[model samples]
Target: MPPEPPDTDPGRLLAELIAIDSVNPDLVPGGGGEAAIAGFCGAWLAARGFEVHRLEKRPGRPSLVAVARGTGGGRSLILNGHLDTVSLADYDGDPLDPCIRDGRMYGRGAFDMKGGIAAMMVAAARATAHGPLRGDVILACVADEEHASSGTEEVLESFTADAAVVTEPSHLEVTLAHKGFAWFDVEIEGRAAHGSRPELGIDAIAKAGHFLVALEELAQRLAQGPAHPLLGTGTVHASVIRGGEEPSTYPAHCRITLERRTVPGESADSVERELTAVLDRLAATVPDFHYRLARGLHREPFAADPEALIVRTLARHAEQTLGHPPAVRAEAFWTDCALLDRAGIPCLLFGVDGAGAHAATEYVDLASLDRVTDILTATIADFCS
Candidate 1:
């Protein structure tokens, strides 16, 4: 028999969350979706007096929005945390088994980011236990953050909040900004002919080398460019490449899929233009070079006003909880905070301290989990009141 759900204690809540397999199916074939975990969370919230709403726009892929309605007029706050995790196959031990040792909880999603999810869950319950605040406290346990973030995307379509906090394991620090990403495909065209007839065939694979070299040059140029105060400069690199099928015949096409990590000022359009310029230059300089650049998925970078009400409130609580000012930091990776910010909801990221986000080993500091819970509870009370 499975273990029962824990009480309001953040550490126990985190353990229960870790024990549930909420791996993103989009990332791993036949992986456990958010169904089981979403059900658990929904029941947990419903039992605690939250009006739980389960969103399953995509069948079998559900996201939960649990709300504690406010009594009167006050700014609502959204506490966001993804319910899905990366593949657990590579975990060093039993991925689903939550263990505690040396004041740390070890499990696949313990750190990134069931810890944050548990903290926020307990915090929201605690903050509104006595009575409803003037503003609503909404806890969003969304799906698909590991792959497409379709869960958050769907949530934004129906819900909006005055402010939000993404619990994404930021080492108990305040993360005001994070890098975005843009994907692109560069297909190089070439003439197919027998290998012996070099004169009749244009080698697409060889031509791709030119683009790869140019891409490196572009990366270097980006490195030399002016950097964002926290996020630094944007970066580009080839992620996947497919070319010649066999050595007996000349290949007709070579496709290169690359990803560009962008700072605040950069966008998919900007990155496309940069790639276009590089390709155009190569076309003009390299002989028989023909190619097409196609833009793929993209997400915008996020930057929060350090002076925003939510930021200040959370930071103050965090400082009080830690007995020291929480350091303001930035992440190179993307998060749902970007989506919330783009939707005009002011948001920042703050969560428990941990390591091994997608590595073979993972763990979250038990003390930090409790501290984060205290910080979030205080912040929610102060901000929503």
Candidate 2:
């Protein structure tokens, strides 16, 4: 049997977590990583008599794992969350400023994460305080989730869990699936020449312009393709572009950055092959207009079995605790849940209600935070039982 849930102070834990500046560099420059937050969590869990391990994938970027043992009768459940936020440089506001007003906690990572981390901690605290459970429970908090997914990847490589619940802000919905992401940089090369002598040399920018048109056409084709039942169709868009050195000279090279959303059955290699074929055909038309494709992040899509024992148990708990059956769906965004899913673990994404993540005035509803904690606590108990 699972231990009785203990009274946990989730609000104080959330405030303390929000106070730490664990914003990823892509979200904020010069902001510290997850070390401080991991340290705090380590101390908190240790003081609660839970077995805790602190793992650092990179210096100053720490990931923590805390475990509570139960009756050793069932598979383990992992509660995973990241302690990172997107860069807050343009906000002109303090990233660490966690202001609670009108039932919302305003902070850089309050919604995108931290809130989930707080709820996990509260659940873990209650589980520890109540006594032994029916099975093991692992609480994992990783770093660099806002930028690169290396943090969660490292965790998956090092540990295994039967099932995982990723605490990514999902408006308290049970997200059993999420789309993958593919990033690429396309570079067009050409000969530089004087602008006055246009006929003497090839213009890289002109070639790049043509290539952009082809890419746009491809994007449209992808958007119109058959959509995935849950995740929808893939999406392709050029996010950044740069080229040309001088106004009076034909540029030698141009580059465009693309972000592509991948649905189920879409692999990074397949996407590359398709794009390569398109560019190859274009190269045949434009003389000496060769291009190179550099791949960036290639996160895989993740889906959990709704019929899995842990998932079903959690869904029941959600309905019982939240007064409504949990909404099951797939997120359009990529998350660390994919990493665990790829490792053969059933993963689900769920968390607090909020808005404006990675934007100015990001905040998490305090009431939702409390509710999430309650849900987490009950879910863990049910899963372990």
The TM-score that candidate 2 achieves is: 0.94
Candidate 1 residue 212 Cα shift, in angstroms, is 0.5
lDDT of 2 by residue, 1-385 (tens): 5633343667777778878877676556687778888899898888887788888858778889888877788678899999877776654477677888899988888888889998988986775566877778988888888778767877777778778888899998889888888899999988789989878767788898888898889989998899888888888888999999999898888998988888888989888998898899999987878799999978887778888876787788889878999898899988888888778888788899988787877889988888888888888877776
Candidate 1 has a TM-score of: 0.98
Model 1 ranges off by over 4 Å = 1-6
lDDT of 2: 0.83
The residue-level lDDT of candidate 1 at 138 comes to: 93
Residue 223, candidate 1: alpha-carbon lDDT: 98
Per-prediction TM-score: 0.98, 0.94
Tens digit of per-residue lDDT, candidate 1, span 1-385? 5532457789888889999999999999899999999999999999999999999999999999999999979999999999999999999999999999999999999999999999999999989989899999999999999999999999998889999999999999999999999999999999999999999998999999999999999999999999999999999999999999798889999999999999999999999999999999999999999999999999999999999999999998888889999999999999999999999999999998989999999999999998999899999999999
Q: Using TM-score, give the best candidate's number.
A: 1
Please give the range of 10 consecutive residues that has the lowest summed lDDT in model 2.
1-10
